[model samples]
Target: MTEISTLIVDGILAVLLVSVIVVCTIVYRRLGTIKSGQAELRALVDQLNTAVVDAQRSVANLKTSATEIEGRLQIEGKKASAIADELGLITEAGNNLADRIERGLSGATAAKKQQAPAETSASKKQQEEILAALREAR
Candidate 1:
């Protein structure tokens, strides 16, 4: 009977040891899975950081380009304003010259009519040809 009891106790201890081993194996596998997942998460974070850095750089470049364009536009706007002012002055001068020419031509025509109250038809034809030539030149 004593030998049989000892055999039963040894059997119980062997079963408990196997159970502990199985539980430890399961826990170890879970820890390995968690470690691999952590590595993957770290890689994802690194990629995200790289993308953010690139985005910031791209934004800076765009800002610089915008600034350059703004400067060019300002310069062009000034040039256009100056040209418009010059054109306005030129138009004013042209109008004044045209008024003077009109007055001079009218005065000359009145003087010619006074000088020749009974001009011949050939003389009138010659005068008309001169007027036509002056108009064409203008």
Candidate 2:
């Protein structure tokens, strides 16, 4: 009876030892997995932070470029307006010159008609021949 009791005690001790080892190994593996997950999460956070910084910088650069383009556009618009004003002035000057030329031509034609009666008939005939020649040249 004493030997049977010893054998039973030994068997229980062996079972308890095996259970403790398995539990310890499982806990160690779980701890390692947790540590690995923490490392991956940290890496993801770092990448997200870097991307945010890069995006902010890009936005700033874009804003600067937009401001520059706006400035250039304003300058060009001013130049275009000045050119349009100059063209308008030139057109007005051309219209004034054309009116002056038309008035001069009409005055010269009236003066020539008034002088025609004072000329001799032979001179008047000669003038008519010259006018016909000029018309044929045109």
- Model 1 misses residue 48 by how many Å? 1.7
* TM-score of each model, in listed order: 0.58, 0.55
Candidate 2 C-alpha lDDT tens digits along 34-82: 9999999999999999999999999999999999999999999999999
Q: Of the candidates shown, which would achieve the greatest TM-score relative to the real structure?
A: 1
Span of 10 residues, lowest total lDDT, candidate 1: 129-138
- lDDT over C-alpha atoms for residue 119 of model 2: 51
Model 1 segments beyond 4 Å from truth? 1-37, 117-138
The lDDT of model 2 is 0.82
Worst 10-residue stretch by lDDT in candidate 2? 129-138
Q: Model 2: how far is 19 from its true place, Å?
A: 6.8
Candidate 1 per-residue lDDT, tens place, 39-120, comes to 9999999999999999999999999999999999999999999999999999788767766776776687789889978767
